[model samples]
Target: MNKCIFFFLSLYLLCFQSFAQTSSVKTVPNADLVYEKTKLGEQVNSPYYEGQPVVSADGKFLFVYRVGHPDNVGYKTYKKDEDIWVGERMADGSFSTMRNVGAPLNTATNNAVLGISGDGNTLFLYDQYNLSADYAVTNIAVSERTTDGWGKPQSIKIKGFRWVSEPAYMNMSVDKRILLISYANNRVTFGKQDLYVSFLEADGTFSEPLNLGKDINTAGIEASPFLAADNVTLYFSTDGRAGYGNLDVFVTKRLDDTWQKWSEPLNLGAKVNTPFWDCEFSMTAKGDVAYFTSGGQNYGENADVYQVKIKEVARPEPVAMIYGKVLNKNTNEPIATKISYTNIKTHQNAGLASSNPKDGTYKIYLPKDKAYSFFAEKDGFFAIKENIDLTGLKTYTEIERNIYLVPIETGVAIELSHLYFMQSQPTLLPSSEDELEQLFDILQKYPTMQIEIAGHTDGVGNKQKNQMLSVQRANAVKDYLVKKGITAERIKTVGYGGSRPIASNEKEETRKLNRRVEFKVLSK
Candidate 1:
């Protein structure tokens, strides 16, 4: 009778704890639940003790905090409050032998599983904080893994907020410009706890904390927020709504350009949640497998880590490519120069690369759907900056761009022909602006071209004075080109004090024709 009762209880627990292997939701028809838990073995026994699992952006490896002793420790000193182990799961679903990540990643001190970085190199853990057990400080620490092993654990201090029990999670935006961190604010414990986000600077420093506001945050406790690789979708744990128990995992997606217009949170449903604590859930970039913490039923003691198949959802893919070129202005010659791309929205630097001198072309791979700023620079030329606001265009789109460089000459004589300026005024006429606009457009279309901006005079006034005026007039033309988004470095201006004339300066009509500004394509 006793054996039968034990058997019945075991079966009931197994049936209730079983992970769903498939999802009928077609939001992500192409993706299926790819990883699942197995019975722990000597290495990783059945119903493997797993929790706080994080997969790489490519779904290649898994990082998790596991606890157990396989090396015959006599079970006496192998207490449940022992060391936290870090395990790596390979593509074959076989986890590398659970290795103590060691101090500072895993200290002799008790640590709670927190979060993992997008690159899978950084890990966040907090000191155990159960007041009843005498562990009550909210100690937060982060460890970075070098090529060798994990580095020393460094603690992060949050100002004005005490009891920083939960370090929450951090991730990249769709464009990878900004780093979003979600943490439970114990600042006001009585009111529902709040979640805050802080930006990561180019130098790896975090900016001032910004409250996510009351929209996504509620007066109820909110914690364990995980940012999807796309950066726009956020998953967090809250007790505001009904679940299997006290806390359930809910997700909120960034809705509009407005920072606060987040969509309402959606419950992950009953199967994944139990009438017990289910929080700190995490998902990979592929949105396939999910990991969380649970204590009741099958899990031996305390909060043990749990894994299950998440319904494949339509999440954004942040990997993509962008390409273009740089060139000379005068002869349309391709100039080999350096160019840099920056993700303004996410604050990510794509690094600097050179355009091919032979063909004046370049290509850059972007993590799709991120806005960027492209800047090109060369000696003796004005730097050019182009702002690309790729709000939602993350597909494999090919962008073709070019740049022009001006000459170094002081002055060159040229016939205006029909190049008419506002009579005697340096202001270019509407028709003249149109002509220059067309030339600028061509330069943009073909990035390897170079050109010279020349000014001429009809010798009607003081030669010296006319020369200076013509120079100014040519500079005005250059400024106009700059306003049209052309690189000023690609436009060299010079005035010929009526020194050289294509048309005879004998008649007012000929002199009128002599006074003008013209561009010559030096290379194509």
Candidate 2:
């Protein structure tokens, strides 16, 4: 009985230890599984092909299509009665209750459902028409949701570039003002069926159209664009870009306002592509779910809709932290301080909890790819300024530094790689005086800046004697700065003894590093 109890206890302890080692992770849903159309409503007409379904903001209604051709341009034998369909998902999970919307919204034209905004206030539809060459010409139209019903459709126009063919298959920006349009068989030299964007002005007119440029548009055909709700990411289809086969859905993202620095286009991969054409891509508002048409085995008939999950490219988590303790130069103890960070790009401010009173350590979370202006201020201590430039950092980093507040001193200790001090000694010696002259030049430039002359000794000999020797060494430096024409009023002297060392006194090199004077900036 005793052996069994011990065995179970050991097993429980091992399990608990394993659980403690693993951190909880947030789960993200697959982007493609959000929407799929399986069957037609019983009340709806025969043999319905209900794909390109966009859900309303409340997730109740789905706006889709029933037929592909209305003008009978390509399908000459099929009926030319293309209609936009609407189905509301009842509370009990059945969509047999589908209804056709009223006039001025769905016409006899080839009106294909594009997308709906999250607020349910705007609906985008693509109207396909026949051109002079018997090819299809597609234009985009938007309808505003009025109190009673949708307003009359307004044709979208983009300036500059003329050949805007397929607007219905494009995605809109977050504000629903900017639209991404695709052109097919147009004489665009860069890529076939390239995508373009046009911004809607305040007067309901669109601005000049601009090509999606090199990162997104490839040499081959690229169409069927979808913008995530964030408005910075774009997902589209292209056969020219790197993919598993024929045409594949790809995604790119905008960094800041610059579209040129977009992420490389990612192929939706084998699950979303097939041997034949797999283009026309659409996604949910959150961007986790993507749906496209494929002539694969899962589809019962020709070119059925298939869904696949997509993940946004993972960005490196920012983990670089600057942690340091501010200490009083005289007492060698921590001090409470206030800190602020100025963003270098936007000149914005960020910080947390000021500086903790219990400990002088301030931990600032630094971004992986941006510079920051770090400022720390306390009532008596002079303000501290540090320009942290992280323009090209890739991985997580950590740094520890100790800030010494110079007592009102004429000379301050500045950390320099070449400066060296003898163990438990405060003498300037023969080697370091040349570097100290550079300090004299710095003090002359900042005339108003006061400083505290600090002296330190390695963890050796009597602590009290080391402290006294450090004071004498600091006085010696003050005399030098004053002789160099620095104002005597700006000078203060403080001796830290062996109590405060920049590095551990374990090695001879560290001991040499510890025994030194730092010309700390007092005020400027």
Candidate 3:
């Protein structure tokens, strides 16, 4: 009777344990689940250690850090140098033959690819070399994608970096405004390594780095931070937090506009984490697939890049992606041009990107829910302006806007899209500064260029009153330019009133278009 009782108790305990395990498995968030794991084939992974995979925003290119190659520039050294290799996605979904990113970026010393910009026009590299037998140094450098491959690299120096901490890895926001860096050995660190962020100030300098705080950083090391294209989700690796094994990848999200606050870190779960080291995770802009480095048995003894279909992953802020080419209006040939965008309501610089001279193609990321004024400018071309309003966006969107810049010649009129004023009043709004500055730049670029600033009012008031208001608005623009140091003689102001309407006055939208400001190049 005693033996039977003991056996029955053991059976009950086993059943209970099984049920608990099943329930726990069911409780995992769908986003934390992965549908499949695929080991990238020889085109990407070799016997050599390949890690730190980053895919292009368009998902057409893959960049990875590779070690132990016979063709390595550091082959003679006792410690082989690591370099970046890139592969193009093939038609069948496999990658093409991997090619070394090559020199200027890779030298006889250790060099690693840190991150690529969302537009795929910039490459960030970590360069470390022995300055002398007694000491070594590591620094981050940037290489711009030019018509003829990557241009020469330039070292990036952050002002006011604490001397004690060493930077591990870095990633930038989709808009290229905020930079996230992992630093080790700083006195303010919450763990062996912690994530810090720096913002691109209006003056074009990086702000002092600030810690991400205790919610994200742990008492153990946290490294390999990757900020998603949405700009809010961050994926990083930590051995400090409770996890399945060494340096498992985890994700957290920015809770608010402040970079310091974050949601609690969530482990990627058993499907993604393993007993061995798993780190250096990155995902596509859409967040459907995740690429990470692992040393699990399935990937062999050495670290290799593996990808999985993540059931759920944190998404970036809702954004509208703009991509297209800038071409010569007449020749239809691609032209390299500078693109600038301004937030119409806040009068803030949204961001800037340049079209690739080689292909004339360019891409930019814009935060949604704001009206924007986009301008494309080049030295000899009359600048063009485009207005976009994304105030009601509910999901990510892509816009194709190919710009054609006309050569600066007499009679070329470029409308000022950003100029605004108080309702029915002649006073210019502060948001007009961006367009005013742009006009200032054009005038400065062509010292002798003469332009006529014209203002028109919608057909909503008395003709005489409308004419007076239009003239005042035009003079207001002229005053701004003169205040900025342009000679008053170079600018002439005029008012068309409601006589010269560009669109019909039947609808408010058309009337808004009719009420406009424009500059016509008179002489250059």
Top lDDT model: 3
Give the range where candidate 1 is weakest over 10 consecutive residues by summed lDDT: 20-29
Name the regions of candidate 2 deviating beyond 4 angstroms.
1-46, 57-59, 68-80, 90-98, 127-139, 161-168, 184-188, 296-301, 309-524
Alpha-carbon error at 114 in model 3, in Å?
1.1
Tens digit per residue, CA lDDT, model 1, 1-524: 99999999999876665432112211212322423422223333323454555555434444555555442122245543344564567667656666655555544344444555433445555643222354545334666555466666676543343443433554333232344445555453323566666554555444555667666677576766777655577877766654445666677777765456787776666555556666666665556566677654332234656666644344434433345557656677777666666665554465444555456565543545556666556654443445566667544344566655454333432223334566656777654433454456766865666677778777777888888878877887788878988877776777776886768878877666677677666655
Clashes of each: 44, 17, 3
List model 2 lDDT by residue over 307-331, tens digit each: 4544433322333556677677677
Question: Please, what is the TM-score per model?
Answer: 0.51, 0.46, 0.84
Per-residue lDDT over 204-271 for candidate 3, one digit per residue giving the tens place of the 0 to 100 score = 66677888998898888788898887677888988776666667778778888777789778777777
Relative to the unseen true structure, what is the C-alpha lDDT of residue 84 in candidate 2, on a scale of 0 to 100? 69
Ranking by TM-score: 3, 1, 2
Kindly report which residue stretches of model 3 are placed more than 4 angstroms away from their true locations once superposed.
1-28, 31-35, 129-138, 162-167, 201-205, 296-301, 311-314, 329-332, 380-382, 404-406, 421-425, 444-449, 457-469, 483-487, 498-514
Q: What does the lDDT read for residue 381 in candidate 3? A: 77
Error (Å) of candidate 3 at residue 469 is: 4.3
